[model samples]
Target: MPTSASAFEIQSDFDAIDFAGGMIAEAKRRTGDNAAIEYACADMFDWLARFPEAYDCILTVGTLHHVDLTSALRAMSRALKPGGRLLVLDLVRRPGWRYVLINSIVWDAPASFVDGVNQIS
Candidate 1:
């Protein structure tokens, strides 16, 4: 099962759901699968509560930053079946010596400067 806090508009072979009505419509138009995508515009915590230890895998990208980190982690942990895998892709800032040095040097820079630095690959 695929889930998203926001809407998705891509076709896929597996099941998918999101918390947006517009996304649901887009999925209906774009998806080729016979099974209709199920969706709900509800809070993640409440939605997740419906399924306990039900999923074999959970994948999230760039979503954890928008919610309570501890609570989200707990919810995901509870929702996963035994031996389930949870994969996450998101940005994180670590406080280390290098980070401290960079912050000290650039903390006073203008927003444009910071953006420019971040744009570097």
Candidate 2:
């Protein structure tokens, strides 16, 4: 498995996702030589751009919310090899005025701001 991120510190945010330093080390220890694990601390888009269609699978968890959905998805698609799979686990918001307002405030944007939801499907 190959993992990419902007940082690998075992801190609050990273720890919550189980991708922090300690977790990665523990996983590596458990897997031993049977698994080939690679980690890179680089911008996802830049990394994907440099290695077009290089990966068999790309897994993203709780990350798209913070990025430009269209751009990120496009990059991920380009980075995927033929018959590749992209598994994304993310939070979904219900469609409504209240939810929109909440998302705007939580994300620090306008009430009409849409992030990736409209772009999908």
Model 1: how far residue 91 lies from native, Å: 4.1
For residues 16-115, write the lDDT of model 1, one tens digit per residue.
5555678667767786555644545566677668888776666655555566555665676666666666666655465544334233321232223322
Relative to the true structure, how large is the alpha-carbon lDDT of every model? Answer: 0.56, 0.56
TM-score of each: 0.54, 0.51
On TM-score, the leading prediction is 1
Worst 10-residue lDDT window, candidate 2 = 10-19
Q: What lDDT tens digits, residue by residue, belong to model 2 across residues 1-121?
A: 4366636634321111232567556655776754235654456777778878776666676666666666776787776676666666666475644334334422422112223334556
- Cα deviation at 69, candidate 1, in Å, is 1.2
Off by over 4 Å in 1: 1-15, 91-121
Model 2 scores a TM of 0.51
